[model samples]
Structures are given as C-alpha cells and as structure tokens.
Target: MKYIWIYAVIPVVYSIMFFSVRGGFLKSAHMLNIRFLSGLSIDDGSVRTALLVIFAANIAAAVITVTGHLGSTAEDGYLLREDYNGQTYTQNLELSISGEERPIEIEVAPRSYSETEKEAILSRAAMKIESIILEGQSAGHINQDLKLISSYEEMPIVISWVTDRPDILDWDGKICRGIPEEGTDVVLTASLEWGELEKEVTIPLTIFPKELTGDEALREKVNEAVSSSNNSEDEKLILPDKIDGKNVVWHSAGSGQGLIVLFAGLLFAALFMFSRIQNRDIQEAKRQEALLYDYPHLVNKLVLLLNAGMSMRAAFEKTAHDYRISLKNGGPKREGFDEIL
Candidate 1:
C-alpha cells in the first residue's frame, strides 16, 4: 500500500517539473529521469512501467520539437524580422532522405559541355590570351638601355581564364625570333589548342636604338677612377671594441598544469555525483528498515482492537487513527500503519 503512494508521487513530481520548469533546470530533470529509468532492475515491473511512461513522454516531446511541430509561434516571430524583408531566407531544417533517388548500377559515361557553351568559353579564353600578349609585348620592348629582356620570364603572368573542359585545352609557349632592329617591329605569336578548337594571337614589338661609340670607353675610365678613390677611403676607416651586454634566460610554462587541474575538476564532479546517488540509496534503505521494524507493533495493536469486540474494519481504522495521533504528537510516522490508513 505504501508503494502505491510512492508510484503516485513519481508521476506528480514529473508533471510539475515538465510544466513549471524551463531551460537548463528542465533539461537536468530529463537527464535525471533517463538515468534513473536506466538504473532500475528488470525484476521491478511496477517501477519499470512507470519509468517507461516517463521516457516515452520525453521522446514524444523531442520528436515534436525536431519536426517543427512545437515552437511555431517563436519561429514565425523570428522570420518576420525587418531585416528579413525583401531578402532570401535560409534555414537549417532537417530533411528526410528516405524517398530520395538512388544511383543505378548501369555504366553511365561522364558529361561533356554542349557545343554553344564550348564556343562561348573559347571566345572568352581568346580575349584573355590577346590581353596577356599585348601587355607582355609592351613590357618586353627594349628601353633606352638597348638591352632585350623577356618580361614574361621575369614575372610569371597569371592567367585568370578557365575553360569548361580544362583537360582538352593545350597552351603552347609564345614564339619570337631574331634580334629586334631599329625601326622594325618584332611579331610574337601564341597558340591555344582545345580538341579541335584552336586560337592564335600575334603582337608586334618595337625597339628604341641608341648609338654605341666612344661613350663606352669614357664610362669605363670614370668607373675605374671612382673605384680607386673608394678603396683608399675604406682603408682609413676604423672600428670600436668592447661592447656591453646582459644575458637573460626565459622558461616556458607548459599545458601540464592546466591538464592536471582539469583532471582534478572532473574527478571531483564524478565523486560528487557518485556520493549523491549512494546517499539516496542509503536513505531509501533506512526508510524501508524503519517500516519493517514497526510492522509487528502495528499488527499487535490491530489484534488488541479486534479482540475488544471491534469489527475488522473498525480495528483497522482505530489502529491507523492512533498511529496518526501519535505522529501528530511528535511520534515516529510508521509507514506500515500509514499504509493501513
């Protein structure tokens, strides 16, 4: 009979927690319910049934939440924000892939671009190639120094152009020949081959000529005279000795201390939870022990009432009434007598 009250209290407590509590407090109750249900022995059929009901309720709530059946008002409010007006909206909603199409086992060949797309791609590539060649030609033209240097080799030209079918596109290096003479244009040609698609671009280069005569000899004599003067000046230079200094050492602190602290914290938390569970079990055992200890006395009182010309129901009621009065008068509340009441 005492077990009936215990069973009734469990559901009542669960109801209050589910309806009244919110946020982390409610989440903690859910976790505790799951843990308690899992720890119950298989032989305890009544307790197991109660636990199953609570577990099922939690699962149903979770399902409703995930399926967007719950909290519809809050979702609608968030979606109606002013910032979302006239803008595309996206959400991280869960989707079921069960009905999606599956891949077939048949041998299917890879896809290639259509003819129109290939032509558009090739035209864009040609424009990019022409721009690069023109820039290279302007940069590579000899300056007043009359020396020729390939600008293409000095700085790598980055080609931002991409083809739809990169595997088929083949690019050959630009070809130019012969020294550029004064007043003559050097033509450089570049070729790109993709399958049957081919494109070629030609650019003309110009050279600026400067006469070379007695100026070379005069420049050499001036450079030699400047070198001799610099050497003599360098010989007269001096150095200073005896520099002051201080030596300091630094030691790095490792993560070992943090790891130790983390481990200690985890150990303390584990022990605390273990102690709480053990204390709860111990208290329950003490309660059951007290009930068993008072059972014989309660039965003896019931027998005395019955023997004094009282009916069975009257004797039971008298025993329960006396136990309640004693409990009210600061006596121990016997579980066995309370169950009878």
Candidate 2:
C-alpha cells in the first residue's frame, strides 16, 4: 500500500508538471519557464528529468538577470534535398549568419569508400564539422565525382541491385531517392579488404546540420545512420572520469543531462528498495508471532503418541522427519519442536 502510493504519486505529479510546461500551460515564449521546457524531453528518462530541472532552474535564474536575443529562424533558412547519381540527400542548407546570402550547399553523391574516407565520415558526424567525405569514389567539385562515378557503371555489371542504392536510404528501409530497380531497397556490395583487419564493417549514417530550430530528432536519426558504419571499429576508447586524477570529467550535453536523469531514476529505485526492506521486516515479525500460536497443538500430539504404545524417542524422531519434508516442499514446519529436547 505504501509503495503503491509512492510510485503512483511521484511520477503522476512530475508528469503533470512536466507536460503543463511542455504545452505552454502557465508560460509564454517571453516567460522563463517556457524557455526552460523547450530544452527538456521526457523520453530521455530520469537522469534527463533531474538534469532538466536543474538546467531549467539555472536558465530561469539567469534569465532573471540576463538578456536573450536569439530569434527562431530566418527566411533564407529553408529545407532542401539534392540528388547525385541515383541517391538522394536532404540537408538543412542555410545561409551564413553574416550579412551574406549565398547558401552553403550539400550535394549527395557516391564516392569510393576508403579507410581514410571512413575516418573522414566519422569526423563529419561530430558536432563541429567542416567537410564531408563520400564513400566508393574520389570527391570532386561535383564534376570529378560524377565523372569518375559514372565509369563504375560502364566498366562491368560486377554486382547488380534490385532496389534503390544504399546511399539514398530513408529512416527505415525505404529509399528516399535513388536509381530505382524492379522492387525497392537494395544495396549491392563488393568490398575489398585492407590491412591486417580480419573483418570489414559497413556503417550507415545521416548527417544533421545546425538549423535555427536545433532539431534533436534529426540529429539522432543522422547519428544512428553514422553509427551503423562504425561497428567495424570495435570498442571505443574509454573516456576517463578524471583529467589529472583530481576531479571527474564532464560532457556538455550527453554526460550533462544524461547523468542528471540517471541519478533521479536511482532515487526512485532507492525509495522502492527501502519500502521492500520495511515490508520484509513486518512479514518476518508476523511470522514469529504466528509460531507461538501453533505450539500447543504439537505438544498435544506428542502427549498422545507417548501414551499409546510408542516410545518417546521414536515419536520425536518420526515427527522430525515429517517436519523436514514439509519444510523442503513449502509445507508448514512442525510447532513446539523447540520445547521437545
């Protein structure tokens, strides 16, 4: 009953508070509370919950004293998709933050996949990226990439595909844009191994650019795609908890909010554990009191056995065997055995 109240009340109250803020319940964009909720997400779990509360409090406290000049989005900042060869690419191509208007374009194309190119692709997946690398063929100023890539078709049909090319993959298996075939969604691969590495791995990744909205969903999708290709790299390098062994290291977003959510979740779990311990103690105490009630019946049975042609020693031994068997099979243990000796 106590546990029922704790789990039910805690999440319910938190959920109402969180959602009310999410839906702009009592605040507007100009208000500090609304701004704080925008940076939060419920699905990120409890660490995010704790971190979110702290982050919001911090932001709101600062807003009480600081100025916020950031606007939503600009007119030149629109969404567009480009196609190269047969694959399709979508990007949030935007103009520079400066007074200039020329958009920084992202062209989708298939280049030869190389060891250096894999490293380059992974680097582009990072937050601050300068250039993107293509797999399969060499990258050119769009001209050279297309020219050299077209030759792969003319050479020979070494491998044939049934659907869209791998480069133009949608979120699931759907191909957004690609050279279409009979069915859909096909990636014909003929890979050449390099170095002494016994296994070769292929990873799929989508690139997310910084837009005025700061779309985390888009970034997560792109991250998933890029991670698919990174499986060949084996375990990642362990990030140290301390720098010079003085204090714990920290990450801004991943470790920051994620850690907070984890800790909050632990609090709820600890509360649950305490409840279980208290309940267990109550049960054990009740069980001991119950033993006192069942004792006199055992005494009456023993008295009958001794009076009838049975010896006291034999009666006691027989009763012990029955009690042991009952205990092993989850039956009740005999009462008053403590007083027999």
Candidate 3:
C-alpha cells in the first residue's frame, strides 16, 4: 500500500503541468527571456512534447523503484515460500540472533530423492571428484595448487577432504614449502555424506616440484641468504655478501636512462611530422594566392575580346593562346594562366 503512493505522484505532477501550460502560466516566458521556456507557447507543439517526456520519465522511475523494493517479501524474519526458485538470488536480510544486517545470496534445492537416485548421484560424484582435485593436471604431474572442495554444490552430498602427505600438500590443498626435486606420492581421501548415507572415495596423485626460470632461481637464492642473515638482537643490520657459492652485488634501481631515450625518440618524431605539415600548408597557400592575384587580368582580356565582336568560344580560345605566348616571353608563372590553357 505504501509503494502505491510512488505511482500516484506521477499522474498528479502530469496533470498540474498540463493545466498550467494550457492556461497562461508560460505566456510571460518569452518576455522574460527564460532559457528553455522562452521558446515554448500555449499552442506550440513543444509544450505537448515536453509534457509527454516528463510524464514518461516519472512513470518509468516510479515503476523501477516499486519493483526493486517490493519484489520479494518476508514475514517474521523468514523468507516467503514463493520467492525461492532453484537458481540463486540475493535478498537484504537481518539476522534475528545477532541483530546484524546483510545481503545474503540464497539458493534452494529439493531434498526429497529416492534411495536409488541418491546412490547414482553419489557414484557419479565420486568419479567427478578426481578431476576436480587434479584441477587440470594428469594424475602423474601435480605441481600447482589443488582444488579441494568441502561440498559439491551440484549434488546433495557434503564432502570432507584429507591428505596422506601433509608436508607436500596440506588439507586446504596448498602446495607446501621445500618440495622435493624428485616427485612424491600422496593419497587424497574424500568422505562423502548425505542425509543418513555415507561413501568414501580415494584418489592417488604424484606431486612434482615447480619449474623455475634462471632469473627466478637466482632471486630465490638471494632471498634465502638475506633471510638467514637477519639477527633481531644485534645492533647493526647485516646484508648478504654471497649466495649459493656466487658473489652478490646490490644496487639501487632508480636509473631513468630507458625512459629518457623513449621520450627523446617520441619528441623527435612529433617535431618531424609538425615541420612536414607546416611546409605543405605554406605551399598550398602560395598557390591559392597566385591564382587569386592573376584572376582580374584574365577577366579583363576576356571582356575586351568579347566586346570586339568575337564569339564566346573564340574569346575563351584567344585568352588561352595569349596566356601561353606570355609564358614563352619571360612572364611570371601563374597557376590561373596554366589552368586556362
């Protein structure tokens, strides 16, 4: 009922604007020189167009707010039954015990399945769990982090994972420190539980060391030597002088030579392009000025030939021939004369 008031404001505002404009409220707008309203009059089409736009925009905003606020309802701190589908959606919810507000994502699934169907889901899930843990590696080459899931969201079962080698791979599937150069074998066990039934799935995996490049290996050695040199109780701090039977040299990394060279190249290219464009524009302007300067003389010659009883075509031909003869005698080159010929 409260949300319905949002729609009522749209009609009331539209009616007021219609009556005010149709009456003479905007008649003084032109005399007052108002920015937008000065161009609108009582009988103008713009008056009707502006009213319709305001009416539409208000109705749209009201509809969006009402639907967004009242889409899902709750009673007594629990969600309404009709709002839950099988897919996920979010709702603003408050916890009764903690008095805390939070937006919770909810997904509801059916719990009633026959015993035969439940067994089939678990059987397929066990086979699927192997690929999920491997995460894209083959069974013989596991070097990165594993994807150990606590629950499978697709099915109804809950899973609890365990590993045999805690040093190589922990319970959270993180690859631990100091992995052996050669591979190590580990067994992962998943305990699957659903309502009252339980099942176990075992996956055997071989874990290998991560491959590192030359630079990465050198940095790792330097880091190990620096970490060993730290003594908290000493007065003076010590830095590592050697790492892995090789000498260590430390320098500050603030050299700007590379950036200086890049900027110099860019500046040179921009200046070269600017000079080329300026030269081309100067040549174009000179050609246009030359043509404009020679236009009056050409027009006078054509008028004199036409007044002496020559036909229009003969006058044009005689003008072109005179321009060519002047060019042969040492007259200045004019673009207009060349175009006439």
Best-fitting candidate, measured by TM-score? Answer: 3
- Comparison by TM-score, 1 against 3, better one: 3
lDDT of 2 by residue, 174-237 (tens): 3242223332322322222223212222333332221223464444544554454456566773
Highest lDDT among the candidates is held by which one? 3
Q: Give lDDT tens digits, candidate 3, residues 1-341.
A: 34578688667856565566665546544434555875544464566677778888888888886776566455334554332125444555543447655665654342356788778887888888889778779888788878788777556689988999989888988777678878899898999988887889988888887555799677777777877898778887677888888777878796899999999999999999999999999999999998898888888888999999999899999988887888889877888777777
Model 2: C-alpha RMSD to truth? Answer: 29.0
For model 3, what is the C-alpha lDDT against the true structure? 0.76
TM-score of each: 0.25, 0.22, 0.38
lDDT of 1 by residue, 1-341 (tens): 11234444555666654443333333444566756645434333454455568956765655655556443333343333223113343434333358763442222233455667556665666566545544434534532221222232222222232222222221222222222354344444455444566555454445433223587544544454455445554756222121122233435669698999999999999999999999999988988998898789888887888889999999988877887898889997677777787
Clashes of 3: 0
TM-score for predicted model 1 compared with the true structure: 0.25
Q: Candidate 2 regions off by >4 Å? A: 1-255, 309-311, 321-341
**Considering lDDT, which of the candidate structures 1 and 2 is the better prediction for this target?**
1
Find the number of clashing residue pairs for candidate 2.
Answer: 18
Order the candidates by lDDT, highest first: 3, 1, 2
Q: What alpha-carbon RMSD in Å does predicted model 3 have with respect to the real structure?
A: 18.2
Stretches of model 1 off by over 4 angstroms after superposition: 1-17, 20-112, 136-183, 207-341
Error of 1 at 185 (Å): 2.3
